[model samples]
Target: MALRANRVRLGIFFVLIMGIFITGIFWVAGGFSSPVTTSYACYFGWSVGGLNVGSTVEYNGVPVGSVSAIEIAPDGRLVKVVLNLEDDKFRVDDTIVASLFFTGITGLQDINLESLPDSVERLWSEDQLTFESDMPVVPVRSGTVQSVASGLNAVFQSMAQVDMKELNDQTIRALTRMNDLLDSVENDSVAVRLSRTIDNFDAVLVTYNDLGNELTAAIRDAREDAEPIVEDLKEFTGELDNLSEQLNMMGADLHNTFNVTNSILQEIRELLPNVNRLLDGFSGGYRGEEIWQ
Candidate 1:
């Protein structure tokens, strides 16, 4: 019984050791405290050559998640990559863009997420998905390689659409016309004519300047000649003012003479009336004397 008890106790100790070893492994492997992650899907129209499962997903260059799965879409026209991202690290919306980027020269590629400017309008609601998938779909943009390739393709297509032969003919005709115009100008002595015209214009300008100076001088001389006339006019006006004063004095003297003559005439008229009355009285006396005689 003692040996059996020892075995049981030893077995229990062994079981406890194994439990602790498992727990330590789980802790080291991050199984005990796994972060809460959300799944998001991205559909790429072009090739995803270097991207694979377990590839890093970066938000503005910071790793925030890892690719969980990669497969072809149901339509078989696109590659769908699923990302398991830590929750609350960043918000996912229509304005967020996912693009592939080469991590190194070894051709390893990763998905990078970036948000557009805040002023950009959100095209879809948060709950809306572009593809019929359980995970929310993040819009995928062309990678650098794909963008370069697309630009080259477009350039080639545009070149192919151009009428090169006609363009070349037009260009040749333009060059020929330009050369003919140069030859015509040279043969017609256009440069010499232009020089002669410029010289004539300069001569005319000089002549106009001389005429302006002469006109200014003539105006100054005329003004000087009129100065004596203006002074004579001032003297004539002063003489007229003196004559008017003399006329006013003569008028005052004539008015005084008229007043004196009227006063003398009035006295003489009064005396004449008295004399007539005296004569009448004297005549009446003479008549009485004659009657008496």
Candidate 2:
């Protein structure tokens, strides 16, 4: 009987140990004890762990719950997810946002979770709320490179389609015209005329230089001769001034003498006429025989 009792006690202990081990396994797999639930509503296109479970719930890099259902009402697309959060920081009305991020050099993709700006104070609860994700903005490097390549291709195509024969003909025509113009200038008599003109210019310059020297010498001689003539004229003008003073007094005496001569001439003219009349009367009396009367 004691041996059976011992066996039964061992069995009970073994079962308890097995139960504890099973409970620990479940706890480890489930990732914690009964955490507080922070319910929220997520949009339809959000995903978790490569699986878009309609609207999924996550907290601190661990999946907590999945979307129970989805519906579209007048307020827009609504998604409801059941959350099992371990902390009180995640509560109702908190904004949930998802972001796509790249990992590894091969550009593997993963979704990152973050609360929307100012979503901390407004925590989520068991209520219909909105969740948003930034729109994916594609980089435009490849488009820019393709545009540059297209421009280069158009330029090369234009150059390749050029007419080489027409260009060569134009070049040849230009060279021939240049040769003809050169030949015309070479055959003209302009070179001989230019030489003659240069010789005449040289002779003219020589004549001009000789005439300039002659004019310089003539000016010097004229200035030397004019000096004495100027002094002589000055002395002559002084003498004429004195002679004019004496002539002025002599003219007054000549005026008085001329008046006396004019009076004597007038008396002589009157006596001549009276003497002729007296002679004519005496001659007539003698001729008529009574001369005394």
TM-score of each model, in listed order: 0.54, 0.26
Query: Which candidate number maximizes TM-score?
Result: 1
Candidate 2 lDDT at 199 equals 60
The sequence of per-residue lDDT tens digits that candidate 2 reaches over residues 208-283 is 5655565566556776676655555565565556556545644544564455456545555644554454344333
Per-residue alpha-carbon lDDT of candidate 1 for residues 209-275, written as tens digits (9 for 90 to 100): 6555655655567766866555555655665565566556556555654654565565556455544
The global C-alpha lDDT for each of the candidates, from Candidate 1 onward, is 0.67, 0.44
Pairs that collide in candidate 1 are: none
List candidate 2 segments past 4 Å from native.
1-5, 17-33, 44-96, 99-111, 115-293
Error of 2 at 243 (Å): 80
- Model 1 regions lying over 4 Å from their true place: 1-32, 104-106, 116-134, 186-192, 214-293
Each candidate: RMSD to true structure?
Answer: 45.9, 50.3
In model 2, the clashing pairs are 91-124, 92-123, 92-124, 92-125, 93-124, 93-125, 94-123, 94-124
